[model samples]
Target: MSDLNKLGLAEARDALRKGDVTSVELTESCLKAIDDADALNAFVHKTPEIALERAKAADARIKEGDAPSMCGLPIGIKDLFCTKGVPSQAASKILEGFKPEYESTVSQQLADAGAVMLGKLNMDEFAMGSSNETSVYGNAVSPWRRGNDDAQLTPGGSSGGSASAVAADLCLAATGTDTGGSIRQPAAFVGITGIKPTYGRCSRWGIVAFASSLDQAGPMTKNVRDAAIMLETMCGHDAKDSTSAELAVPNFEAMLTGDIKGKKIGIPKEYRMDGMPAEIEKLWADGAAMLKDAGAEIVDISLPHTKYALPAYYVIAPAEASSNLARYDGVRYGRRAHLAQGDGITEMYEKTRAEGFGHEVQRRVMIGTYVLSAGFYDAYYNRARRVRTLIKKDFEDVFAAGVDAILTPATPSASFGLGEMTEADPVQMYLNDVFTVTVNLAGLPGVSVPAGLDAQGLPLGLQLIGRPWEEGDLLNTAYALENAAGFVAKPGKWW
Candidate 1:
């Protein structure tokens, strides 16, 4: 138990119940690891005092013999989550000094179940961008490196910091919000497991809004079992969020039998894009082969509308973002720009937004505003909404035809260098979400499991898209894939 920080959530939970380790030990180990790994820039805020106090309380709760499964585990909270008295900036300059007096429902649920919060993690500003470079706290670098190469690599974005922290064992797991591929892409890049549950599965109240319709919070963990444990604790019906589902939260961890027998796994033909890397293609095929070996039938299916997903998502997400971000005026709770004597309210609004938002945020806001404008509403926004309906129908059709799950490559490539895509056309970066945006668009449950490595020995993942509200079954399939892949390769600890 020397490196208690490296224990996964399930592992730590069992150990705490068996009286083998104290919560304070686990918290201290993680705190020390966090302090030593500042080069990764994964954690933007540290809460060692609160963490130690919570750890002690968790230890007492465990001794009472009626503790929950997550009773003594230490985990990281994404900056998007509003933790009371903690800096929850969403990595944007507009919210520089913002600390919430209330806690987000998901974080509150975890706290109520006795999970200790390590700190708030870094993320892309307002959950924009595919890489972590847009964060006000700077980028969160991947713990993984190419074979014998010294170049720094991106940990994917929006949920980049959560993926990095879990992969590097700074915490047992972390919370992640996925608008497009924020959770899954970063998990793939860092060689971990991440799931974006079906829309409305987790409460959205208190999380900084990016895209109201697409945003869902999930877990990033060391393995499928850890993800299952954390996800169960994070989901429930919340009256506070109108979008929250009113269904019963299943015991996701208990459903992990790692048996996918008789399950129909679909391989979407449209996922085979031109110019997709040979390594990715091979990895995807190999994943299908593994699932077939696990007694699951692999069937070829068609999601013909897949080609329109990225563009439609780009239009719709930005439109929602433009509306959601309008509330961050200088008069609000966050940072306000200094005004000159003659500045009117309109000028104040313009100056504050221009100065507060990052470049990517500004770009998306502009795009959103243009699409929502009266003249173009019918042309862009309405058309994208119609396409989104078609996209959702495509998935419903596939599922109605008896497909239990669909498999695709999680990302087109492995972790790229940190500054590699910033100078290129922004569309080059948007292409990174090619394989993942469809899940959000369709409001389906999607999980990324590390399947194999590329030529440079960096991890690549295969995604599983499950039927709506069937995350338990989806996680069972993911557990099967996790066992089949046996992906236990951790980074060599360069940090």
Candidate 2:
């Protein structure tokens, strides 16, 4: 059981049940890994005391013979999730010292299932950036590096730390919420698996709001099986979240039979953007061939409104974010800026917000406010809403044509240097979400599976977009791809 931290979720679960290892040992192993990997800036807050206590309880639970599948496993919680009495900053300065008295429903469910939380992992400030550089805790560096190159790269955002931690084996898996491609992009960047369940499939209660309509929590794990095992525990109906799906929790792990024999996987033509790297293009073609070899039908499909997804997302997400973030005035909890003697409440509000939010968050809030303003509401917000409908309809039309899943490149490119995109026009950063925003707009299930590596040996992933609420089928399709690709490359231990 040496290097117990490297075991995937299902592996650790079975090992604990078989008495081959104890939860405390696994927790300690992960804690040690987390401590050693601070160079990556993944785990922003460490909770070793709480983790050890929970591990002891999980060991006792396993001994009782009625343990759940996640019992006695260690995992990381994204900073977006509020753990009872733990710092839940969402990686922004505004919520710096705010600790919730209650736990987020998803994290609570995992805790109830006997999963030990290592700490709050870092992310983009308020889940607003494509790269991890915008975080108050600084960038969550990717564990992966370009072949023989020493440059640091971003793990992808908002959920950057989760991807870094899971890929580095600092934890067996981590919870990540995807507003756009926060979960999937990072998963792809770090050469791991991440799934964003259909909107409302997982409870959003207690997770900091970042575009309520698009935010859905899912698992970032080392493999599809680990994702399945973790996702099953993280999902279900929660009355606390109006957006949470009221559906039965399927046994997702059992659904991974890896038999996509007669399934139809759509290859969206619109995903073939101009200037797409030849390496990415080749990797995509190779992925389609692999799926075809697995006995799946690869049909050409059209999501015509794909080009409009990014604009629609930027508009609608920022609009919702502006409204959601308005609650963080100096009056309530979280950080409050120091005020002058003559400062009124209005001045206090203005000063606190300007100081608290990061540049990216401020930029989005302003854009949101401007769009929702009376003069431009119809021209911006309303039009964007209409475009969102068209985007959703595009997927519905494709699915009606009997497409079980749509396959596309998860990211336009592989992991880039830490400050690469941010230095140029901010739009460059927005382009990173081009391949992923559509799924969020359509409220569909999408999973990113590491398919192959690029020329520099950096990992590239292929996304499997599923019919709404059909994550099981999507995951099974991804399982077929995973087996075909046989991608087992782990980043060399540079940290």
Residue-pair clashes per candidate: 0, 0
- Lowest summed-lDDT stretch of 10 residues in model 1? 418-427
TM-score of each: 0.99, 0.99
Q: Candidate 2, residues 50-161: lDDT per residue as tens digits?
A: 9999999999999999899998899999999999999999999999799999999999999999999999999999999988888999999999999999999999998999
Clashing pairs in 2: none
Candidate 1 lDDT over residue span 1-495, tens digit each: 899999999889989999999999999999999999999999999999999999999999999998999987999999999999999999999998999999999999999999999999989999997889999999998999999999999999889999999999999999999999999999999999999999999999999999999999999999999999999999999999999999999999899999999999999999999999999999999999999999999999999999999999999999999999999998968988889999999988989898899999999999999999999999999999999999999999999999999999999999899889974589999999999999999999999999999999999999999999999999999999999999999999999
- The true-structure Cα RMSD of candidate 1 reads 0.7
TM-score of model 2 vs. true structure: 0.99
Worst 10 residues of 2 by lDDT: 418-427
